[model samples]
Target: MEVTQANILETLPQDMIVEILSRVGQNSSDQLLILKSVCKSFLKLSEDPLVLKRLSLDRWRLSPWGNPKLIYLFNLCTVFGNPNAIFCLGLIGYFDTKYTDLGLDFLKRASNSQLKEAVYVYGVIIFASHQIEAKHVGLQILNETFPPVPELVVAVRIKVFDLMRQLWLFNRHPFDDVAMPCPISDHDGYFPQFHGFEIAIPECMSCFWAYELDVFANRFAYN
Candidate 1:
């Protein structure tokens, strides 16, 4: 039998094919989508939950939102236990007030996975939204001690500095007018929330910071 590209891909193990396809998806969405037309094996590999999860991460890593197709992929990833994708979906929820409640829950699950970026982003949004729960969660994140890893130490210090800069540059400060409230539960009470404005400096800074954390997570897991 001739060792053609199709033959070679078919000969590789499913795990190897998935990893290769995932890497392709990460580097180039256009190329990754093109692979769906390559062959049945490649098509199947592209549709795997794991691959879709990674694709979703790469799709929305730079921006807070994407087209409907990426959102569909993210929804699938959330079902497949991709915490980072969950966080992304939650972050996207910020685009519309109607979705903020659901977004908050998604962020909560992602943070519980010990994703530091999720924790920080979630805390910032809730705090900015002025939810009372932010008080407790904020205290936990500020106080929670992680082992002395130099990278995390550096990330945390940078995070604090960014937070201060954001506070100073943006009017995320308290306002006399109360924000529209989305009640989480019967027992929960509402507070004045921050209204939506343009995707401001604070969000961009938080996004860059989250990307930094993502780099750390990838390094620890894959490198």
Candidate 2:
């Protein structure tokens, strides 16, 4: 009897195989690729919509969009009803001024699913838009009523507060709209520099203090 990788994978429960693939997709993209190349069963599992959804969300959090792999997977998984993939696709559109309306439509679908990240980003996109109606609608999404699920309230509040804090920090920056370099053009660099200062400031301040202390000590020392 000839044995094969597919045969071994086929012996496991389908959901169990999917769970393993999902975890692999979440943790290591390289390993997932290797697995996918090993056998038909592994490849199929790797392409599972749920696994792809997790991979897309991780990529969205870690990397800039429009990567071919992300776009392909996102488009395919979206057809399978992956709300996160839909949200990410909408985000790509929202970030581009020309597609703002289209982006809003995708975001609206994801928001209806109560995907917290989608809701928060949708609000940001709308608020940043030039259209008056968009701004009003975005604000409403940001401040949407807490759901009746008691267990979700705390998490939802934290996400909202985090977004609000980021917005507050953004508004506090000294530059006006015209003077500011467009963040959208360099979203990866600029967004974190300005909005993520809560985390960055502490680390940066410590380094600054260390440098200052060294300079002062050197200046005071006698030759």
Candidate 3:
């Protein structure tokens, strides 16, 4: 007997099937959509809450001005509590004046879910505020996100940077105002500077990381 994919699926338990479907398409929505079209069972399994929550909508350019169908699909994932979806929705909400509060709520939920990108973005937004107490809380959140150990900090920063870059490209928007640098200076007296497209190193690691976040925020702000 020639064993087919459907045959394999039928032989496996439902939980195991869900795990397999969740892993398919490298978490890409496009690949998952293809899988869904293969048959009715695959289509039904694709919408399983577990599968939806695990789906990554990164490949889809999520924007109010973008593809409506894709946006709807992304929203469906968000309804299923997909962290990436929640994070993206938070960004969209944060940028729009009407949905700012709701956006922050989404971001907070994503951050609590241990989504590193959400934590970094949410922390930066709070840190960038004018309120001193908020800044302290933001700094604390950032500290927890990046960790104190040098090696771990480097690894987390690298991952966060890549995630930010992808997100920046995924949702590009234009703003009239340019992003201004934070007024806070380094405690070590090293002048904060920008080295063209790269983040300049400063004496204080905190200052350096904060500067990087400011730059990331600026990129999103300007375009």
**Lowest summed lDDT window (length 10), candidate 2:** 167-176
Model 1, global lDDT: 0.54
- Model 3 per-residue lDDT tens digits across residues 97-203: 46678988999988887787788778777776656687678777877776544344445556545545434333333222314243365254334454674444554
Alpha-carbon RMSD to native, per candidate: 13.2, 14.1, 5.7
What ranking emerges by TM-score with the best candidate at the front?
3, 1, 2
What is the C-alpha local distance difference test score of each model?
Answer: 0.54, 0.54, 0.66
Error of 1 at 104 (Å): 1.1
Query: Comparing candidate 1 with candidate 3, which one achieves the higher lDDT?
Result: 3
TM-score of each: 0.50, 0.47, 0.70
For residues 115-145, what per-residue lDDT tens digits would candidate 1 score against the true structure?
A: 6667766654443434556544543553253
Residue 184 in model 1: lDDT: 32
Cand. 2 TM to true fold: 0.47
